[model samples]
Target chain A: MMTAQIKEFPGVGLRESDFEQRKVLYTEWVPNARYAWDAGVAIGRYLAELKEGRLIGVRCRHCRRTVIPPRVFCEWCFRPMDEWVPLPDTGTVNTFSLCYVTWDMRRLTEPEIPAVIDIDGTHPPVGILHLLGEVEPQAVQIGMRVQAVWKPPEERTGSILDIRYFRPVREG
Target chain B: MTRKVAIVGIGYTGCRPLTAEVSYKELVYEAAVKAYEDAGLDPRRDVDSFVTVAEDFIEGTSIFDEYTPDQLGGMLKPNVTIPGEGIHGLATAYLQIASGLVDVVVVEAHSKASNVLTLPHITAYAMDPVYNRPLQANPIFIAGMEMNRYMWATGATQEQCAQVVVKNKRCALYNPTAAYGANLEIDDVLAAEMVAYPLGRQEISPHADGAVVLVLAAGEVAESLTDLPIWIRGIGWCNDAPSLETRGWGRAIYAEGAGKMAYQMAGIRNPMEEIDFAELDDTYAYKELQHLEALGFCQFGEAGILTAEGVTEPGGALPVNVSGGNLGCGHLLDAAGLRAVVEVVLQLRGEAGSHQLPDVETGLAFGWRGLPSTSGAVVILSN
Candidate 1:
C-alpha cells in the first residue's frame, strides 16, 4: 500500500433536471462573429488558377522541387519560389481514410473518403488533402491512380472546393 | 555550475469523464491548494510566478488566461499562459528558474472536454483553412491516413496496434486515478468498430476532465522544502512541418528531435538501457508505436516486436505507461503531458501503490498536441 494517499476529489455532475432548475440562475450567450480571411499571395494565385480550370504549383529553384498548394516562399530554402508551373490533374493516392462521421459530429450513413493525392508534375509526394468520389470505399488503395473532377467552368469559385473531388483515373 | 530546477510538490483533481459540480477555475484551485500544502509553502509568499496552459477554441473563451490566476492563488504575482501543452508550460517555468529570474514557480493546466459540443469542428478549425479545412472531413481521418502510411511503410500489422490497446487499458486496472481502466484483450480491441481504417473506436482515448498543478523550485530551495524532489534531468520539444503533406508520414520527427536534445542534456547516450520506463502519448493506439520509434526506444519500425514480446508491459523489461497512458487514463488535452508527469513523479517516489514498479529512479514522458499539429514535448525526471 502507498504510504501517503491523496484523497479523491469528487465533482458533482449536474443532471438534466438540475440544468433545467438552474436555468434561471445562470447566464448564457452565443458568440456572434464573422470572418473573411484573405487567401494571401500564393494561395490566392492557386485559387485563381483553379478558377481557370488548371492545376498549378510554385517551383523552389534552390531545392529544385515544385510544391503544390503553392507558397510564395520556400519553407526549406527560406527563399522566394522562382516560377509558376502547371501540374497535371491526375495523381496517385498517397494515403486515404473512410470517414463515418462529419466534421460537426454527425454520424453519416454514407462514409466520406478523404485522401492525400500526390499531383503529377509536382515534386514526389507533394500532395494535397481532398475528398475521393465516384469510387467505392473498398476500391480505394494507397498508390491508386486518381484525377481531379473540376466543377463546371460557370460554377467554379476561386476556392479549393472548385475541384469537386478526385475520382479513379480510367485507363486507355 | 548550472542551476537545476526540481519538482518539489504536485497535486491533481478530477480524473473523470465529466466534472460538472465545479467550474474549471474551482478545479484549478483544488489542485493548487493541495500542491501548496504538499510543498509546505504559501503561494501568496513563496511562489514567485505562475504558468497555465490552455487553448482558446476549446474553452470557447478568448483570453482564457484572464480567468486563471485567482484560483491558482497567483492573484498579483507574475502569471502567464502558454498556448501549448502542460509540459510546455513546465518547460517555460524550468527556463525561468534556470535563468535565475525566480526561485519558486507554479505550473497549472486543466481540461473540461465534456463542455465541448463540437470537438471535431474545433479540430477542423485548427487545420489550414485554404488547403485542409474546406474538405469538411472529420479530423480523425488524418490519423487514419497516417496510420495507414505507417503500417504500409513499416509492415506493422493492425494486430500489433490492437495489442497496444490491450496492454495500456489493462495496465489502468491497477491505477486508482485512471478513469477508463478495463480488462481488454487484443481480440476485443480488434473486434471494435473502426472509426477510421486502422484505428478502432476502442483504440482512441476518451476525453477526460482533470487538472494538475506542480510546484518547481531551484535546487537549494527544493532540498530545503522537500526530501522527495524529482529533479528535471532533461526537457525538449520540437515541431515538424506545419503542413501535413511535407512531414514524415511513418515516424514522428518532432519527438525524435525533442528526445535527442533532452537526452543530450541528461548525458544519456542510450535511452533503452539507461532510462527506466516511459509514459508516452497514446491518444491513438498507432501513435504509441510511432512515438516509440521516434523517441529512440527501439530501431525504426521495431516497437511492434518489442511490444509483442511483452517488453513494454508492467512487470516486463520496460514497463511503459503503467498508469494506463491516455488510452486508459483518458485524454486531458493540454493537461495530458502533466498527467504523465504526475504519474512519473508517483512512480519515482514509490507512491504509485498498486501500480508501483520497483526501484524506479528515472523516467521519461512524451506528449503530443494531437492531430493537424505536429508539436510535441519531452521531459525526464529523476529522484
Candidate 2:
C-alpha cells in the first residue's frame, strides 16, 4: 500500500482570518449500490472467458468485425454480437503517455507510462489498455511492438488487471 | 425552424462538497419536483419529452440512463440520454422543440462525486485506454500541461493565475450557496498545496454533489405558462480534435468555434459590449481565463491580466460567473452547465437577489467538457 504525506496551506493575509487553521474534515457517505443489469451481465461473461487463458472478442455478425472489450452490440450496425472468437494478444503500440504520478494525485517515486496497445493479429486492431512495464518513458514510440505479460493462474482476477502489463518483445 | 423555444421554469439544489442526507435518485427528484412546481405543471402529464446528461464512467455505473427515468418521473416517455456535458443535452432538447417534434422538454443534470470511492480511477477510465492511461498521470497533470503552455505561449505568470482564485472566492463570499466561499488572497492561493506544477489545489473546482433541472417549451406554450420566460436566442456546441499533442493547448478552439456559432445565430457581433454578463465554465482558475480569451472577451494571454483588473467582477465591464461559478460553488459534473443556465435565468427574471448584476438583458452561458479532450457549448439567453 502507498501513502502520501498531507500538506496544508499556511496562513496568508485574508485566508488566515476567514477559515479555521489546521483543520481537516472527513466524512463517510456512501450511496446505494445499483447496477445496470444488462451491462453488468455482459461484462461478467467477458471476464469469465479471460480466466481460461484465452482472449475473447465479441464478433458483430452483420459487419463481420470483432470488437475487443466486448460490447453487447455493434456501434455501427446496431446489431447484436452473436459470436465470440479467440484473439491474439500480440500488438503494436498506437499511442502512449508517460505518467510520473499515482492514482490519488501523489507523485510516485518511480514513474510509469501507460500505453494503448493495438493487437496486430486482429482485424481493425483489438486495442486493450494496460501498463507498459520495463520500458523507458522516452523510448516509448507510437507503433512500438509489444506483447502481454499474463499473471499466474492463482493471482488472476476476472478483471482487466489480470494482465500485469505489456512489455516489449525482442526481435530475432 | 418553426417554433421558438423559451425556458419556462428552472430549479437548482444547493452546491455542497457532500450531501449526506440524500441519495442520487432523491437529489434528482428534489430538483425535478421544484422545477415542476415552478412551471405549475404535472411532470407525469405535461412533460412531453425528457433528456438527461451523464457519462457512464463519471457516475461509476454503466448505462446510467436506465435508472434515471424513475427519479425524474419520466417512467415511459420520449426519453434519451447524452453521454456528455449538460449543455450539449440542452442543445439537443432545444433543437427538438424548434423542429416542432416536441412541444415541451424537461432536461435534468446531476452529480454525486462524493459517492465515488476513487475519483482518479474513475477519471482514468475516460482516457484512451491503450495510450493515455498508461502514463499513470493523474488528470490534473493535463491541466498543469495546459497551464504551462498557456503561460509559455501567452506570457502569463503564476501570480495572475492565483489572482483568479482570489477574486472568484471573494465573489463567492457574497453567494449564500457557494460551498468554497472565502476571503482568499493571492498569497493564500500561492501558498496552498500544489496538486500539479503551476496548478495549485485552490485553482481547481472542488468535487461536489447537486442537481439542476429546466423546463423548456415552445414560445406559445411558454407565454401562456409564465409571465417571465427566458428566451433561448441561440445554441451551439462543438468538440475539438481529440489528440492533446496535436491540438492548440494555449487557446480553447472548441469554445471559440461554439461561441462564434452561437453569436452568429443570435445576431450579436460585439459580445464584449452587447452581452450584459456571462457565465463561463471555471472548473479551473486558468480555464476561466482561458475560456474568456477564447470567447473573444479579451485577447489570448490577456485574460489573466483582465481578471486581475476586476474586469470580470460584478461592477466591472463584464461580470463573469456571478453565481460564483464552478470555482466558488462546488463542481457537480453534468449539472455544472445547467447551473450556469439557471443563474442566467434567475438574473434575467430579476430573481438573482443579492448576486444579481446591473441591467442584465442578454447573457451567455458557456460549458466545457474538461480533461482527456475538449467539448464545449455556448447558449445565448434573452428576456
Candidate 3:
C-alpha cells in the first residue's frame, strides 16, 4: 500500500443551474491584439505573383528544396533562399477534409472540401490547403489530380483566395 | 555534478467542463495549497522558484505570467512561465533542481477553456497570416487533413480510431475526476455529426477547466520531503515544423524525436518492453495511435491493431490511458499534461483506488501542444 495519501482534493465545479442563474460573479473584457504582419521579402513576392495568377517558390542552394509560399531563409539550412523558382498551378490532392461546419462551429448547408494540394512545380507534400470543387464529396480521393481554379483577374486581391479553389483535372 | 529529481507533491482542481465557482486564480491557489501541504513545505520558507505553463492567446490576456504569481505563492520569487504544455513546465522545474540553484521548485498549469467564447477565431490567429490565414478557415481543418493523411499512410481505419474513444471513455467511468465518461460505441461515433471528413464531433475532445500544481525536489531534498517520491527517470520535448505547408502529414515527427531523446536519457532501448504503461495526449483519437507509433510502443500502423486486440486495455499487456485520457476526462488545455501526470503519480504510488494496476513500476506520460504546433514532450517516471 502507498504510505502517502491525499486528505482532500479541492476543485469546485460550476453546475449548470448556478451558471444559468447568474450565481457566479463575472466580468468580461476583450483585449485587441491586432497586427499588420510584415510578409518579408519572399512572401511579399509570392503574394505579388498570386495577384497575376501564377505561383512562385524560393529555392535553397544548400538544401536543394524549393519552398513555396516562399521565405527568404531556408528553415533547414539556416541560409538565405537565393533563387526564385516558377511552379505550375496544378497539383494533386495529398489529403482532404469535407467540413460540414464553419470556422465557429456553426452548421453549413454545403460542406467545404478543404485539401492540401501538392502544387505541380513545388516539392512533394509541400502543398497549399484550399477548398475543392467540381466533384462530389465522396469522389474526392488522395492522389487525385487537381488544378487551381483562379478568381477572375479583376477579382484578384494578392491573397491565397485569388485561387478560388482546386478542381479535379479531367484527363483527355 | 547533477542530482536526480523526483516529483515530491501533486495537486489538482478538476477535470470539469466548467469551473465557474472559482476564477482561474482561485483554482490555481487551491491546487497549490494542496500541493504545498502534501509536501509539508511552506511556499515562502522552503520553495526556491516557480514555473507555470500557459498561453497568452488561450487565456485571452496578454503577459499572462504577471497575473499568475499571486495564486501560486510565487510573488516576489523567481517565477518562470512557459506557453506550452504542462510537461514542458515540469521539464523546466527539473532543470532548476538539476542546476542546484533551487532545492524545491513549484510548477503550475491550468485551463479556463470555457472562458473563451472565440476559441476557433483565436486559434485561427496561429495560422500563417500571409499564406494560410487568407483562406479564412477554422484551424480544425488542419487536424482533419492530418487524420486523413495518417489513415492513408498507416492503413488505420476510422472504426479503429473510434475504438479509442470507446475504450478511454469507458475507462473514465471508474475515474472520479473525469467529466465525459460514457459507454459509447464505434457506430455512435461514426454516425455522429462530421465536423471535418473522417473527423467527427464525437471523436474530438471537448474543452474543460482545471488546474494542476506539482512540487519538485532533487536528490537529498526529495528524499527528505516524501517517502514515496516518484523519481523522474527521463524527460524529452521536440518540435518538427510550425508551417502546415512543410510538416510531414503522415507521422508525428516531433513525438518520434522526443521519444528518442527521453529514451536515450533513461537508457531505454526497447520502450515496448521497458515501460509499463502510458498516458499519451489524445486531443484527437487518431493522435493516440500516431503517438503510440512515434513513442516506440508499436510499429507504424500497429497501434490500431494492438488496441483492437485489447493490448492497451487496463487488464492487458500494456495499458494506455487507464485514468481516462483527455477524451474521457475532459481536455484541460495547457493543464491537460499535468492532469496525466497526476494519474501516473497515483498509479505509481499504488494510490489509484479504482484505477490502480498491480505490480506496476516504470510509467510514461506524454503531452502535445495541440493545433498548428508540432511540439511534444515525454517524461518517464518510476517508483
**Native-referenced Cα lDDT, model 3:** 0.87
Q: Write the per-residue lDDT of candidate 2 for residues B108-155, one digit (tens) a residue.
A: 999888877677766655666555656767887888999999889888
- Which residue pairs clash within candidate 2? A99-B135, A113-B134, A114-B134, A114-B135, A115-B130, A115-B134, A116-B130, A116-B131
| Candidate 3 regions with alpha-carbon error over 4 angstroms | A1-172
> How much is the lDDT of residue B260 in candidate 1?
92
Residue A130 displacement in candidate 1 (angstroms):
49
- For residues A48-81, what per-residue lDDT tens digits would candidate 1 score against the true structure? 9999999889998788899897866554543457
Residue pairs with backbone atoms closer than 3 Å in model 3 (clashes): none
lDDT of 2 by residue, A72-172 (tens): 54544434568777787778988888787888888876777788888764567768888897787778888889988888888887778778888988878
- DockQ of the two-chain complex in candidate 1: 0.01
- Order of quality (lDDT): 1, 3, 2
- Where does model 1 sit among the CAPRI classes? incorrect
Residue-wise lDDT of candidate 1 within B94-205, one digit each (tens)?
A: 9999899999999999988877877777787787766776676888999999999999988888989988999999998888889999998888999999899988999899
Clashes of 2: 8
Pairs of residues clashing in candidate 1: none
User: What lDDT score is found at residue B235 in candidate 2?
Assistant: 89
